[model samples]
Target: MSEAAEKFETAMPAWKQWQEAPWGRLRYAIAEANPLRHFGERADEPLRVLDLAGGDDGDALRLAVRGHHVTIADYAPAMLTAAAGCVAAAGLTDLVSCVEADANALPADIVRGEFDVVLCHNLLQYVE
Candidate 1:
């Protein structure tokens, strides 16, 4: 594993605990918000969405609830596990799927993947 990823795994427990807390959740709040604000006219039509580093934030699952098929690509396996659990709990197995991906060196799951909407809320400054 890469040094950064390995370090993140070591800090997984604390990260998860914080992320599960209400305050942390508020940082990525979208589940209960107006989906229309983000989608505008496309809100009604079902669109394929690619959520990079989406993890277990519940954002992808919420999009699936809106009838859009969502693929959540996260670098961390544990995060994907949590996201899978949430997806299954929401009975959105068909609408939501997970893939392991690292933006630094993306795999076909992300490189060749096709989608109508791509959500990457995290600040990603492209060096190139």
Candidate 2:
């Protein structure tokens, strides 16, 4: 893993806690509207989305709830575990999936061009 990824992996526990807090939920609620606004005309269609460095997959769950297929990818395995739990809790197993991967070097199976939308919120600052 890259240095940034390792650092994030170490911080996953704290991250998970904060993500369940009010502010985190608020942040996701605010950001969730973007995809719908942008894809307003295609509301009936199921869009494929990728949430890069999407720890805990809160945002992915939101998108999935909107009827989109979402993949939450993070370098931290713990984050993916938490994300999986969120997916299950939301009962969105058919719409959301998790992948452990480095954002700097994502696996070929998750090419950017394959997704209709790519959510990269709050991830760039950690990239190196």
Candidate 3:
């Protein structure tokens, strides 16, 4: 596996634990950093958004709840699984998709601009 993938695998447990915490500073940080508002008030149309390094924390799921079609991509399978569960729990299965792919090497289809918004949050630190 690539170094980035290895690091993500190593960090998955801590990430999960961090996300499990009750409404904390991290939650506020995520809300503050969220890009959804930038999409503006005319966000009725389901926007195709890509979330790189998106853990199982439900940030993308929150966007989906707001009527966005979201793709949650992560290098770690465990993270992707967690994201999927988050989507399911939110009853947003139709609005969210999960992919196990490294951020550095996104699928060709995505590189071709399949999404309207691409998020690379908290991922650059792990990239080689």
Candidate 4:
């Protein structure tokens, strides 16, 4: 296994702790990790965005809602499931897609040079 994978395995899994957190708490902690401000006044402009290690708090949901294509990628299945649920509840299933991916080594499927923006919200801390 890669050293990054090993570090992830040895560390207390962030996804697990996130699962136990109140929805509001996690949402506030990592609120919109930069997508909004980065867009400046181009809120109406749609772009393909990849949210690396995106938790289940809908941090990037705002982007997805505003007609931007968002892929919420994470290492945790549970978080992805919750994220799917949130997107579904918001009727954004068509706008947002959730997938399981490791930040250290992403799959070729996700690595295709197709995205216009990439947001790694709260992912660096877990990456080595």
CA lDDT of each candidate?
A: 0.74, 0.83, 0.74, 0.72
Winner on lDDT between 3 and 4 is: 3
Per-residue lDDT of candidate 3, residues 35-126 (tens digit): 75677764667889888877664568667877888888887776777778878888998988887777777888767867888776666776
Candidate 3, superposed: residue stretches over 4 Å from native: 1-3, 22-29
lDDT tens digits, residue span 50-126, model 4? 88887663565777777898888877666677788889899988889887778767889899859988887677777
How large is the C-alpha RMSD of every model relative to the true structure?
3.0, 2.0, 2.6, 4.4
| Candidate that beats the other on TM-score, 1 or 2, i.e. the better one | 2
Query: How do the residues 14-80 of candidate 1 rate in per-residue lDDT, one tens digit apiece?
Result: 8778868997688656543644477888888989888877766467877888799988877777778
Minimum summed lDDT over a 10-residue window in model 1 is located at 119-128
Tell me the lDDT of model 2 at 118: 88
Which 10 successive residues of model 2 have the least lDDT summed?
A: 1-10
How far does residue 44 in candidate 4 sit from its true spot (Å)? 1.0
Over the full model, what C-alpha lDDT does candidate 4 score relative to the true structure? 0.72
Top TM-score model: 2
